[model samples]
Target: MPRSRMLEYDGAAWHEDCFLCSGCRKPIGSEAFVPDNRRFYCLACYEQQVAPRCSHCRKALTKGGLTYRGEVWHRDCFLCCGCGSALAGQTFTSQGERPYCVRCFSSLYAKKCAACNTPITGFGDGKYVSFEERQWHQPCFKCSRCSVSLIGSGFFPDRDQILCADCNSDD
Candidate 1:
């Protein structure tokens, strides 16, 4: 026969009343008391728990759902404010009130052009076989040889390279 162990506190010995599984309140051996949620439970009931997963990444959601703009989204499924793109599987997070996609967000760091000293709105390979190197907006720089603005012109000529109507007429 096995001897029953009495519950003991710092300086007092006591016996538990109504031994039950803390999770399901089912009867259990006096020795099976497992503390949980401020109550004791048998091992079997504690092992049957389930946790929620995030809808966006399908990972366990440790915290909970986030409410943004009146919509509930998993922390990972939120969209960037700048590009309106989904933000799943990304390591970076924006602390701003609105999020931004990687590309649109990087525009914040773009520097102004050195030649014209204007904000760089766009970029392209500035290579004309005949002319020296130059960085220009589509409308800013004319063909070096023609001096005509290359706004709507289908083509613009450099020293030897033929240019557009504006460039062709300038010289």
Candidate 2:
């Protein structure tokens, strides 16, 4: 048999790549060309070849829309700069900046116990207290059963909670 180069449409013949629809490959006559590109296509096929939707939100991202990390996530889905964790359900310290996670923010201001030299676990009046022959933050110091810092603020022999000056004023 012989090959057919003639595209038949509604009893009319058209040339290849000349008046054929770019999408459905059907014959088109004097259709409007899209801006910047002269490709011709039927109205139905033109709509079908429109821009794709976002992968993350499944929303149509038209021209001038943003695409992040090759996926289309909303601007609010970005992570925190301090810990690089996703930001959600937390108050930001900086008005215009993304907030750090609890873990990251706590580590930023937490201080080491004077006696044990471990990170303080609770709030205090910015002072250290003696407990079991060791010094700890006022709130973190505790009795064996009561686990509370002494009320009177003074030092005792071999019993004191004094932190180094360098560790006291750190931010």
Candidate closest to the true structure, highest lDDT: 1
lDDT of 2 at 139: 56
lDDT of 1 by residue, 1-171 (tens): 135545553455444444566677665655554555556556555535422444455554435566554545676567776666767555323436665555665466434442354544333433222124434554555545555665455555444454666646666
How big is the positional error of residue 106 in model 1, measured in Å on the Cα after superposition?
3.2
What root-mean-square deviation over C-alphas does model 2 reach?
A: 14.3
Overall lDDT per candidate, in order of appearance: 0.51, 0.50
lDDT of 2: 0.50
Best candidate, TM-score-wise? Answer: 2
| Deviating ranges (above 4 Å) for candidate 2 | 1-78, 91-98, 115-136, 142-148, 156-171
Please give the distance, in angstroms, between residue 93's alpha carbon in candidate 1 and its true position after superposition: 6.3
lDDT for predicted candidate 1 compared with the true structure: 0.51
